[model samples]
Target: MTQTSATPLPPPEERRRLREAASLTQAQVAAQVGASRETVRAWENGRTTPRGHRKEAYAQLLSSLAAQTAAQEAVGEAEVTWRQQSTRPLTPAQAFDALYAFCAPALVRQTYLLTGRRELARESVERAFQFAWQRWPEVARDRDPAGWVRATAYDFALSPWHRFRPRYRHPEPPPADASDRALLDVLLKLPPPQRRALLLYDGVGLDLPETAAESEASTPATARRLLHARAAVADRLPALSDPTELHRRLAELASAERLRAAKPPTVRDSSERRARFWTRAAIAFTVTLIGTTALTLRTAPTRYEPPVPPGQTVLGVPPKVAPGPLSEREVELRRKLREETASGPVRLVPETR
Candidate 1:
C-alpha cells in the first residue's frame, strides 16, 4: 500500500493578504462567522483577533467552504470561492476587543435606561470592559460572549451591595420617558424566573435554548417562562395602549444608546506619572488598623468583679435579729415543779428551822 503525503497549509497572515488582494470586503468575510462587518475589519486590520470557540468555528467554516468550492470547480462550476480565514489565530486581546465591541452598545443602552445618565452608562460599560478583559480567555471561548457579558453587567448593576457602597455615584433618570415607564411596567409584571428568561431571550436576543442555560431551567421550562412573561405583558398592554408603542419606544431607547457611546477612558503607563502611592498606602493602613481593632475586640476575654460590702462594720458578717418569747404553758410547768419540792410528800423531814 502507498502512503499519501499531505501538503502543509498556509498561515492565517498569508491567507488574509490573499483575501484582501482579491478585493473582498470585511463584511463579506464576517458573513461566514455570522459576525458583523466591523468585527471582520477589526480582525483584518490588527485591531483585534479571533479567539477560542470563534477560532475553531472560523477555521471549520474556511476549510469546509474551501473543500466544497474545490469539489464544485472540479465538476465545472465557474463561481470563485472566497477564502474565509481569520486574520490571526485566537488571542486573549483580540477576543477581549471583539466581545467589548459586541456588548458595548447593548450594555450602554441598558445603563442609560436604568440611570438616565450617559456618563453613568459610559462608566458602567468601561468597567464591564475591564472585567471582560480580565476573563477574556474564557469568554472568548464561549459560544455567546455577548450574552454572557450582558448577564454579568446586569448582575453588577443590580447588586445589593452597590446600593450603599458604590465606586462612584450618579443620580439620573432613564431615557425615553414614556418608553421607560412602559418597559418598567412590563418588567414589573413579570415573575423573577419569567423576567430573567424574557430579558435573556428578547432584550439580549438569545434563543430559547441559550436563555434556558442562563436561567438554569429545561428548554420547555424556559419557553414557558417566556410565554408567561409575554402573557403577563400582553394582559397589561391593553390597559396601557398599543403594544407597538412599546417596541417603538424600545427602538428609541436603542437609538439613544448610540448617541451615548463614549470613547473608553485610557490611563497612561509612565514612570514619571508616579502618584497616589502615599494616599493609597494611608488608606490601606487605616483599613488594616480598623480590622485589627475589630479582631482584638472579638477575641478579648470578659472579667466580672464581686460587689463590695457596706463600709462601716464588717466584711462578711450579716446583721442579727432579737429573740421572741415561748408560750404561757412553760410558766405553769415551772410553778408546779416548785410546789412539789416544798411539799415533799406532805412531811417536813430534816427541817432544822
Candidate 2:
C-alpha cells in the first residue's frame, strides 16, 4: 500500500474488512506487524493511529490481505466445492446436494445460536433446505442460494409461532456455561427484529446495507435496531460491548456446541419425499373439490323455491258451552227411566198387534 509515493492506508472499516477477508485474527495481524493485539484493534477501529515502521508494516499486511481477498474472490472459495456440479451441466439432485453439503452444517450452527435448541436448529436447517429443493428452479436462479436458505432457516428458527407448538412451548435447556447461558438469555429477550438484525450483522458478517436488505428495513432503521441490540447486550454483558468481541463470542458459542446437520443425500431424499406428499395432498384436495362441485350442480334445484309458509292462527269460531247441573224435571225423568224394566211396556203391545 505504501510502495508508490507512500500511499495512505485504506479507511478503518476497509482495514478491518481486509484483515477479516484474509481470515487473519487481530492477534495474528499484531504478531505479523510487531505490535500488540490491542494496538491492531485500535488501528482497525480508528481509535489510535499507528506510526513509523509499525504503520508501514500494517500497510504491507493490509496490501497482502487485499491481494489475498481479491484472489479468493476471483478464484472463489465456495465455488470450488460446486465447480463440477454448478459449472458443468448436472442433474438437479447433484446441484442440490452440492449446495446442501456446502451450506447445511454452518446453517445448523447458526440456527442453533438463534434458537438455543439443537433439535430445533437441525429441523430448521432441514426445513429450509427442503423449501429450497422444493423450489429448486427458483433457488437455482437466485443470486445467492445460500442466502435464500439462510433467510428461511432464520425465519423458521426465530418464529414467534414456534412458541405455540408443543415441542417448542417450553424453554430449551441453557448452555452449559453460565456466561453463555446469560448471553443467550439476553439475546432471546430482544425483539425478533432486533435479534435478527444483530445476528445478520455481527454474527453473520454481513455489511450494514446487506443486513438492512435482509431485515427488510431502511438503512437508518436497520442501524437503529442494530445499535439497540448491541446496547442491550452490552448492558447485560459489559465485556461484549465491542462488535468484534460480540462476533468472536457468537462464533465461540456456536462452535462450542456439537451441532450436526443431516447428510446431503438424506436432505435431498427427505425434501423429495416432502414435495411428493404435499403434491399428493394438493391433488386430493382438488379432486374432492371437483367431486363436491359436481354433486352440488347435479342435485341442486334449477330454480329458486319459496319456503313453505308458516302455520297461521285460526279466526274466532263458536264458543261451545260446557254442560251445567241438570234441572229437577230432567232428573226425575232419568230416575224413572232407570227404574223401569228393559222390554215391558211398549214391546208387549207391538207383539200382540
Candidate 3:
C-alpha cells in the first residue's frame, strides 16, 4: 500500500495563510479564480467554499504559493537579521547616512505605491532627500524626519506637472507573490487621499492622528477613509481581516518594496544650484537697474535758452525811429505867437535901444 500524507488545513485557514505567504490581496486571487472578491472572502472566512473543479484549482494555487513563500521566507529571515544588526546609532553626519540608508528605500517604495510610476517615485524620493540634506539641522531635530521626507516625496509624486511629461516607465520588480501585486492593484485603484491614508497608517506604521495630519484630513475623516479602505482590503483578502495581521502584512509589503530597488543616491547637494540662482538674480537686478537708468537718461529732455521774439531784447532797448513834420495847426499857432511877440516887443526894443 502507498503511503498517504495527512489531510491539509481547512480552506479558510489555508486560504488566509497562503494569501499572506504569497503577499496577495483577495482581489488578486479572485481575479485568478474568476470569482468575486467577496466570494473569496467568504471562502476564507469559512462562510463558503468553491465547489468541485474551482476548489481543486484554488487548493493547487495555495499549495504552490505556500511552497514559494517558504523558500523566500528562509532567505528573507537571514537578510532581516543582517539588516537589524547593521542599524545602529552614530554621529551627526553618520546619522544622516544612517537615516538615508534606513529611510530612502522605504520612502521611494511609499512614493511608488502612491504614483505607480517607478521613475517618478525614484525622483520624488531623491528630491525629498535632497531637500532634507539641504536642511539637515531642522530635519535632524524633528521628531519624525523620515515622515517629513515621506510626506514631501508623496507630494512630489502627485505633482500635476507629471501629466505633461512623456512617461519614462521603469519596469517594476515582479511582486514577491500574487498577494502583494493584488494589494498594490487595489491600492492603485483608490483615490490618492484614501491611498495615502492607508499607506501612512498601515504601510508606514503611523497612528490615526498622524495619518490624518499627513493626509491633510481631519481625524474623523481619516478614520472613515481607513475604515472604508480596510473593508475593501478585507473583502479581497480575508487574511487581512485580522487587524494585527493587516498591519503586519502591510509592513512586510512595505519592506519588500524597499528591497526591490537600491536606495537611490542622496540627491547631489543643491547648494551649487542655490548659489547659481542667487547669482543670476543679482545679475538680473543689476542689469535692470542699469537699463532703467540708461533709458531715463536717453529719453530725458535737454535744457537750453528759448529763442526771443524778433523785436524783443533781453535788455529792454527800443528800436530807433525818424520824427514826423509839425502839423498845420501847430505852425499857424506858432506864427500868431511870433506876431504878437513882435508887436509887443516893438516898444520894449525901442526903449532897450
Q: 182-228, model 3: which lDDT tens digit per residue?
A: 87777777777888888888877789999988778899999999888
Candidate 2, residue 308: lDDT: 100
Q: Which ten residues in a row have the lowest lDDT in candidate 3?
A: 1-10
Top candidate on lDDT is 2
lDDT of 3 at 83: 85
Give the lowest summed-lDDT range of ten residues in model 1. Answer: 1-10
For all the candidates, what are their Cα RMSDs to the real structure? 18.6, 16.9, 21.9
For residues 163-206, could you state the per-residue lDDT of candidate 1 as single tens digits? 46454364544444665566665664566677667656665567
Select the stronger candidate by lDDT from 2 and 3. 2
For model 1, the stretches where C-alpha displacement exceeds 4 angstroms are: 1-85, 111-121, 165-171, 174-180, 188-193, 217-221, 239-249, 257-259, 262-353
**Candidate 2, residue 127: lDDT:** 94
TM-score of each: 0.45, 0.62, 0.51
Q: What's the ranking of the predictions by TM-score, best on top?
A: 2, 3, 1
Could you tell me the lDDT of residue 108 within candidate 3? 72
Q: Give the C-alpha miss distance for residue 244 in model 3, angstroms.
A: 2.8
Q: Model 2, range 1-353, lDDT digits (tens) per residue?
A: 43632747899999999988878899999999899999999998999988888888888778888888888887786677668655678798988988988999888888887888899999999999989988999999999899999999998888778878898877777889988888889988888899889988999899999998877899999999999999999999999999999999999888888889988888888988988998999999999999999999999999999999999988897788999998999999888776564554774333533
